[model samples]
Every structure is written in structure tokens, then in C-alpha cells.
Target: MTAITINFNNVVKLNVDQFYQLCRDNPDVKFERNQLGEIIIMPPTGGETGKCNASMIADFVIWNRQTKLAEVFDSSTCFKLPNGSDRSPDVSWIKLERWNVLKPEQREKFPPIAPDFVLELMSSSDSLSETQAKMQEYVNAGVKLGWLIDRKTRRVEIYRQGQPKEILEFPTSLCGEDILPGFVLDLQIIWN
Candidate 1:
């Protein structure tokens, strides 16, 4: 896909939940916006890039599962937030109890509920400040933990509730800490 090719002219601002419905109504399109209301869309992928970072996230999830951690998603789908935003983070997960509260129907669509944890893999086209702002939104929206993974610098920024963010540089490992308890992601494999 030729990234964000949609012309978002005259599309009034939409809230997160409403945005989700828009996507469902228009399956051929994708949407995303910043807090300032700049909307963008991209063409559906034809799989021309072979594999992306999302695939590596799958590998990581499998590894997490083997260690008894239930990691649910790896960019398999995008999430619609209440702020008229649709984002496909590198990976995201919810704790069992909180996820169980969803009605069967809501569960199917994976409602705009905040994830217990979210991970964003920084792509070359992504801006650092913008990504950080997105992470902040997740945190403010009730996400318990978030990670901004930068493969270029091989560093990871860990964001936790009610605490200052922590950054881990290359040659180091990233831990789930309180979020997944004992789960560790070896940064070397992620960049490889």
C-alpha cells in the first residue's frame, strides 16, 4: 500500500467510537488522526512488503505465551479509540479480568477500551514526538503500561501508571515488570 493515500476533505471530526463505526461501514478504508484532528488514510495492503514488524511481534507473543504470559494481539487488527482515532500499535494486550467484562458483541469488535498494555514499534516514517503523544493518550485513557520500541536506536521507553517513564538502551533487555511479571523481551532479537 502507498501509505495514507486517502483525501480526508470535509470529513467532520469523529469521536473514537464513531470512528470505529465509520471503518466498519467503509471496509475499504483506514483512518487515523492526531489530537489536532488531522486525518489520514492508507490503501489496503497487498502484502508487497513481504513481512513487517508486526510479524516479529507475533514471534514475541508466542514466546511470551510459552512463558505463561497471555499476550493477545500483534497488529493483526487496528483499534478505534474514542477520539476518532484508529491506530495499529505493534502489539497490545488486556488482562483477563478486565477483558472479560465486555459483552459478547463488544468483544467481537474489540471495543475502544484501553488495553492493559500497548507497544508501538517506531517505523522510519514515524515521528518520535507524535508516537510519544500517542503513548501518552493510551496512558491517560487508562492503559496500565506502554512501550515505545525504537528498533533504529535499539532502545525501549517504558511507561507505567502513576510513575515516571523509563528508557532502556541497546545491549539491554526489556522487562514486563509489574505488567506481565517476570516476562522479558530480549531487545537483540527484536532488532535482528
Candidate 2:
């Protein structure tokens, strides 16, 4: 099933603490809040999507282990963006310096800082337009780089801070460039 959005703006607006509590109460559900305070209830991924997501996260983790320059996060971690939205990317990484700046308490809950890099792996239930809009939101919220990977289409949309998005068709791999030195994501596993 695709995501279902609930608009409570007209009735009640949940603060960060309330939202956190709601998430804590529902441990099995995945939810995201847009800038307008609309709660998006996302369905869990299917087996194939889960496998692909795990593979992608593993690749990032391996690269992070070697570099030690950034902190890598999986899908479960959400961030409070500067634009008043809370989002969780499929795979995200923050520079060590940026991560270190957060207080211990701040790190325990949703981080209030944007990630340096984020990757969204589209699942069967995801809406392409919605995902694209989410990627653009990440860019606007100070994300240095972002990738929206659509497995069905074998396409990758690369988002850079100040440049227009670049679309790649069936690329074998993706370079991290200056943002993540010496890191390259192998797309063969994902494409297959």
C-alpha cells in the first residue's frame, strides 16, 4: 500500500515532543511529518525492497567504516529539518563535525540537523512525485547531496546543493565526489 497522509492542521497541531511521543507509542509504524504538519503514514517495504535497502545501507556502512569521516545512519533515524519538517531518508550520512555539534540530549531524539548526504531507495508503494518533492525538500534544507534511486526505472536522480538535479540512466555506479571522498556506490546489486 502507498503512504496515507493525515492532515490535523485544522484540528490540532502536534509539537515535536508530541510527535516523538506518538512515534514512541507506535513502535511498528513508520511516520513522517511534512512542513505543513501533515503526518504521512508509510507502509512497510516488501521483501525485495527490504533486501535492496539492506544492501544499500551495508555498502554505506562499509564505506563509512573505512573513511571514519562521517556518521552513517539507517532508515530508522529521523531528522528535524530547518524547514519544520521531520524526515527519514533510506540512508543518510552526516559529517563528523556536524554530528559532534549536537548535544548529547539532542542526539538521543530526532537530530535537528540536516544530513550531508541522503539516499532514498524507492519501494513499490512509494509515489514518485512525492519522493521527488521530498528530495527537493532535503536540498532546500541544506543537504549537500542527495540521491533518489528508482529501481523499477533503473534511474538515479542526483541532487546537489546549488546545481540542478542530474539524472543517470542505468548507471553501473555513483561517485561520492568531494562530499564523500573515495566512496563509490555499486548499483549492480540494486539494479539486479
**lDDT for each candidate structure:** 0.68, 0.95
TM-score of candidate 2 against the unseen true structure? 0.99
- What clash count does candidate 2 reach? 0
Write down the lDDT that model 2 would get.
0.95
Off by over 4 Å in 2: none
For all predicted structures, in order, the TM-scores are: 0.76, 0.99
Q: Give the TM-score of candidate 1.
A: 0.76
lDDT of 1 by residue, 9-111 (tens): 4667665566667767887766665545565664443331214454656656776677654447755466555554566666787776766777777766745
lDDT of 1: 0.68
